[model samples]
Target: MKKLYIFVLVLLSWNLQGQGLPGLGAGTTPNNKPILHGKSWVAITGKPLGASAGATIFNQGGNAVDAACAMIAATSTMWDVLSWGGETQALIYNPHTKKVIAINALGYAPTGATVDFYKSQGMDYPPQYGPLAATTPGTPGGIMTMLAEYGTMSLEQILKPSMDLAKGYPLEAQTANAMEAQKARIKQWPYSKKIFLPHLGEEREAPEVGEIFVQEDLYETLSKLVEAEKNALAEGKSRKEAIYAAYDRFYKGDIAKEIVRGTREQGGLFTESDLANWKVKIEEPLHVNYKGIDVYKLQEWTQGPALLQSLNILENFDLKSMGYNSANYIHTLYQAMSLAFADRDFYYGDPAFVDSPMEGLLSKEYAKERAKLIKEINDPKIGPGDPYPFQGGTNPYSDILNQNKEALASLPADQLNSSLDPAFIEAFQSGTTSVETADAEGWVVSVTPSGGWIPAVVAGNTGVGLSQRMQSFVLDENLNPYNLPEPGKRPRVTLTPSLALKDGKPMLAFAVQGGDSQDQNLLQLFLNMVEFGMDVQEATEAANINSYQMQSSFGNHEVRPGAIVLRKDTPAWVNKELVDRGYQIELWNKTSGPLNAIWFDWKHGSFWGGSSDYGDDYGIAW
Candidate 1:
């Protein structure tokens, strides 16, 4: 009997240590929502309707890829801070190929979007709204491509939920209020005014909460896509070819014509050739092995590699020993993030346009060298390091690096120490939404889709919103030479989706929104699970620290050196320790995130889905 008791106690201790439940040394609160467990499938996204769309697809005998596409379509149609005109970036873990791939559906700058043109217009950066700020649409192409390549469902079946929604759905209070708040901007676009404001002359022009918001134009546009697919299928085209037929219709056929005409009518720079030529790229994703797990991210075009770099640096420390959310752990993470983001600000851009030295930047040796620079106190003046040497190449932009350092050094002391500007915070935490889906069939997808949020300019009668992603570009080469506002060049964006594998099997699929803070929140979420052993739910809803040390990807591209955001419930001792370390701390009731994740519980052969408490993020599991 004593032996039996000892055996049970040992088993309990192991489970607690491995799971990191409450009171098991993991600094996480009781999850606001319980973890969703599923043996067959799970769908989680930014909105309930979006999750339901994915669940509907799963119920109809679809894989994770199909469900994810459905969720993307549904969320885009619902205007969940994104629309069909926005860009999509996804990381898909294919169960058959046993490999992860990246979907690069980011739109490039349209015709006449050169830095010289913006300079001639007396603007330092692209306009923030309206036609002048739009990029060529990419979401339609992205959804079609993913569906054709890995999905096992017809385009009609996959898009039906969203099509039904485009006709009309009960408007949520959050989206309704957002439209009302930006009604003036929506009114500026004739097509948007026609759809968004039902009672223009009244106190509330936007639709009321729970009102059946009808979008006839959007419904018609979606119908065109389905019609194209149906026509191709009737003509004896294969399933993949039929999907491509829909893709071509959106990118190169009548739909493209309407989009270009509508954009031009609103003073936008889109041309017929621009729409016809833009295509989605399916490429091998980048990965770095930390410990025994392989972590994957999209290429240099996004802020993804920053997370990998942080992992490489943090791998050098014993994070589990440091305790979760401890002052030392937080400082280490901040320093590592600052170092990685410093490199991102200077080196990350479209690989087609710039040699970003990614091979060297992700090297463990390079991370070790960068990690050595982290001191006890915060270093607000940290600048990008020369990664060329690590790659066995000479730094071509050495002078630019020095200039950037000098410019940062020249900033006023007060500006560096001041609290985060409201404008800056708003832009830094700008728009986006995430979709995470998994199935028993072994397919998993993580997507971060954004642009064309509220206040977007709807393109004429097409009912498609124009992407405001052009504002991510910098007009001056000094800011980011590789990401200059050149026509046909893709902008370096903050959208990122993450996947990880352990023992050559899917371990976690996760993503989040919040523009520049995407990777910051993602990094913490990852560490919370892997290092601290918190379950998917606790890790996602757990409080995280946000560092404003890197340059913002939106608005004026400003940076707030040494600024840190902590949860209001953070211990006072922790705050004192950080302030003593030369940090400017702000305590918010909530840190920025609505992170969604699916943890593949290989031991139990099930999936654990987590949708953070913030926002309307929801999930379904069975």
Candidate 2:
């Protein structure tokens, strides 16, 4: 009853509040009493309630790292897109220390996972079974790591808000819609259905905005962690043990058994040993110098290298002179992306398994070699480039041959006739709910947590389909494996979280949530803020575009026609230039991505942040 009362009060408060920004979905509300007086934070998630979860942490005196963890936990409950059981990567900036740290919270393949092992089982590759496909979730590991290194608040204190919210809260329309969309699968998992389907035996419409939504099992799970933490503290258990215990409950205890059993029964490959041996790897971040700014990016294991390459190519062009979002500007950006992506397909991979010279690849000299390919004024239909020989020679046809082989191999032998069709190539361009925040104490964080292409609907996991991440692999033209299967290799991913600094201080903290569009959106937003001198709000409001017309570093080799997509709100002059550039223009009804950003204006001595009002729910606080 008390819980119901508190929920009602929150609902009332929500109704009375004014909406925050334009692109930030429906539930955002601005708080005048900023959490950081001279500092600001922007958090973007798949749902509004999720952003609020993190904002609450900021209000409770937690720093940006804490806020990021809180937001991730909250979003796991509400969005179900990515959860604690998924991969996580982050870039944290500590202004006081004047240092930036990268956290690779990506899960490793199980010890039992080997290329030969799959062949022995008569399966060509490891299947995407929920259990088999599940990597040890890195979100929890990453969060704990950050908390231990930088956060001031205790784990229990930091997690309280998420725990409370998980006990029960009013379901929103978006969440309810997702539930309905995956109803059949939810009904399969009795435990999941128990939490998601409260109506049970009775027929009823899905729970609405104000109705209570509870996940008792999840609550119990979290409660056990809290209790274990307390008990460990009392029993003199080391901090590592307490953390391990909390993680054990999910991966090695009852939950682990359930996951293992489910996978085994489904003929999956995840073994108990796999769970026991999993550990997160910490590696150096990929950094590049762009226009006098030292830009830091994640390594090749993710799509970070692509952004580095794109920036390098962009630096070759006079982008500002071309004008922001103008046809010339967009064309140059697309061309740069194309050249960079071409290199990405052939070279980017796990450094441990593949001899990918990521450092050399991102070097200024390499950028210079790649930049020479871009024309200053002419925009041809940009194509991919060949990988530079490790021995330092050019092999112009190497990438083309490799890409053709990959395309042919991916198709079934019987369907090989249509395998190399250009139409099919263009279909691949389709592809993060990200979070960013900075506290007054100078702790800044950017996180991109994602699970792509839902696999088979897991029975009883509340229509919560697992990620078919295995599809991210790349193959050769004759269908031979180019990026050979290897255990513990981080698949080339599109999710990259970024931070920008000026004058040795955290100037702009930004991230974009869109697969291939991430770097494109980030580039646009950066230019909007730095070149055009737009404020956070205006920068966010500015319309931007992306393309499948370009090739990428990963296996997405489709080159789309000259089609440029723009927000309906873009000015007529911008549209005219796009048409003049021979682009078939398409207007996106809702902005395509949720780009959340916060900037520190040294000149004004103030902090400003804004969230996109796109199809995402985002918020900002200072």
- Ten consecutive residues with minimal summed lDDT in candidate 2? 18-27
List, residue by residue over 447-562, the lDDT tens digit for candidate 2.
88765222233322322224434435443322222344556655566678887776688777777766666777777777766665555655665567765554332233344455
RMSD of 1: 3.5
TM-score list, all predictions: 0.95, 0.80
Q: Model 1, range 1-622, lDDT digits (tens) per residue? A: 9999987876675545433344533433346798999999999999999999999999999999999999999999999999999999999998888999999999999888899998998998898888989989999999999999999899999999999998889999989999998998888888889988998899999999999998888888889999999999999999999999999998888888988888888789999899888889998889999889999999999999999999998989999988877899889999999999999988888887787899899999999999999999998988988888888998888899899899988977776754787788988999799999999989999999988898889887877888999988888878777788777888899999999999999999999999889999999998888877788887888789999999999888888888999998778999999999988898887774899999998888999999998789999999
Candidate 1 global CA lDDT score = 0.89
For each candidate in turn, give its C-alpha RMSD to the true structure in angstroms: 3.5, 9.6
Error of 2 at 307 (Å): 1.7
Question: Taking the candidates one at a time, how many backbone clashes does each contain?
Answer: 0, 26
- Model 2 TM-score, all chains together: 0.80
